[model samples]
Target: MTDDKTLGVYDEKAGDYARLMDHDTIAPTALNKFLSALPERGTVLDLGCGPGSWARYMVKAGFRVDAIDASAGMVEKASAIEGLNVWQADFSDIQDVAKYDGIWANFSLLHARRAEMPAHLARLKTALRSDGRLHLGLKEGTGEARDSLGRFYTYYTVAEIRDLLARIGLSVSDLRTGADKGLDGTVAAWFTLTAHG
Candidate 1:
């Protein structure tokens, strides 16, 4: 289930959030790496795609992109991207099996409760086709907390994430770690892991 308060935060500040993501240098590099691991014109899901900037990039790159976000505000923005299929849906709603060649889950699954994460990852793993790529970006820390903007997050240590993915049969192939200022105006440690099943 989606957190209502987090949805409210995104709905009210969608534009600001979009602008912040637009300038993220690290994500694009990670995106490029993720893309390189996929076949040409592969199917890709921008899961929890805030504002759909990365989805827009993938669409422009000739991938069949389906972007999903829980916030209606975000769906409105992502829908504006030509050649992109986007919708509003929570993480818990995903149930596809072997449907995508690549899933860009960057920083999106972090919104799930820690207790809910293992199940979520299992669903995502089930959603991927054989040898499909899954890119995950998550904050590096412990426990759950709401940021200043009232957006909820669940943090994980690098080892914890690696183990979680391994248990679900997704092997981490590459990783990048860094800190960046988020829309909430704080720098936090985060990591992106490129995994494949």
Candidate 2:
């Protein structure tokens, strides 16, 4: 589910968040894995596609892209990108059935409360065709917290992530854990997983 308080943070700081284009993307190897898993010319849905950076990246990489975010400001910024199908809606409520060949939830789903995660993940499975790919990025930790900027976040351990994916009928293909600077200048632990249903 979408958290109104967290959405408010993104809405109010959309420009600052857009500046996240500075660090911008996952590793090249991860990119190659994601592409190799998809069908040639397949469509991709970018959940919580803040600022359109990855939407632009995926389009350039040859996938058709549909990006959505709950923040109106995020939608405004992302919609400026030429040819991007940017929508203003919460990803948890996404109702498409078998519509995408890949779902890119890069650091996006973390905003949802843990209690709300399973249902939304089930939705992701419903959104994808059989064997469709999922590239997920999540903060690595055991619980939830709010950032200095007031954005709510739910973190997970690698085991928790694996279990969550498995319960949703996804088969884990690869998992990578690392650290990166957060928007607040703190070192953040993160995990990236590649899975297929």
Candidate 3:
């Protein structure tokens, strides 16, 4: 589990945090692509599902979705959404293994410390079915810390992410990077990685 102090930061800003993401557009597109590649519909886990926007979308798309987040406020918000099964848990605290067909970790794993990424990636793999697909996104660069608004973040290079996946027994099927300019003038080097066990 995340420390009490870190969870407090997210709890304080869960609403603003939900407002920051463009889930209506970005989430559907990403999820559609991920689902299209799958052989069949299966249980999906929305890892670090902030306010459960993606989880809600997945449910609407006919996929069973279980979501988890560290913030109580975020969990509360997500739990209120009809048809979403949201849990209040941190990635580091996850112990279930080989239980999901797909895991969506959009822009969330970036918050993990760089040194802790490999182990976390392995944990994700352990939570997946043998043929499970993983869709991950992260900011491109190096460093770690909270932003001005108190949300934690970390950046990664393509090579670094690829290596982590490889070491954790996931084979990278696709990787792409591009610039996404947000309203705040932050040009994020975003990437989508498709991997399988």
- Report the Cα lDDT for candidate 1: 0.91
lDDT order of candidates, best first?
Answer: 1, 2, 3
The runs of at least 3 residues in candidate 3 whose Cα sits more than 4 Å from the true structure, single-residue gaps closed, are 1-6, 22-24, 181-185
lDDT of 3 by residue, 26-125 (tens): 5566778888765565788898898887888788878888899887898998998787778888788767788888999987787777778888888888
TM per prediction: 0.98, 0.94, 0.88
Off by over 4 Å in 2: 25-29
Task: Looking at model 1, report the run of 10 residues with the lowest lDDT sum.
Answer: 168-177
Candidate lDDT scores, in order, read 0.91, 0.85, 0.78
- Write model 1 residue lDDT over 1-197, tens digit each, in one string: 39999999999999998999878899888999899889999999999998999999999899999999999999998889999999999888889999999999999999999999999888888899998999999999998999999999999998999999889877887888999999899999999998886
- Best by the TM-score measure: 1
Which has the greatest lDDT?
1
Position 65, candidate 3: lDDT: 85
RMSD of 1: 0.8
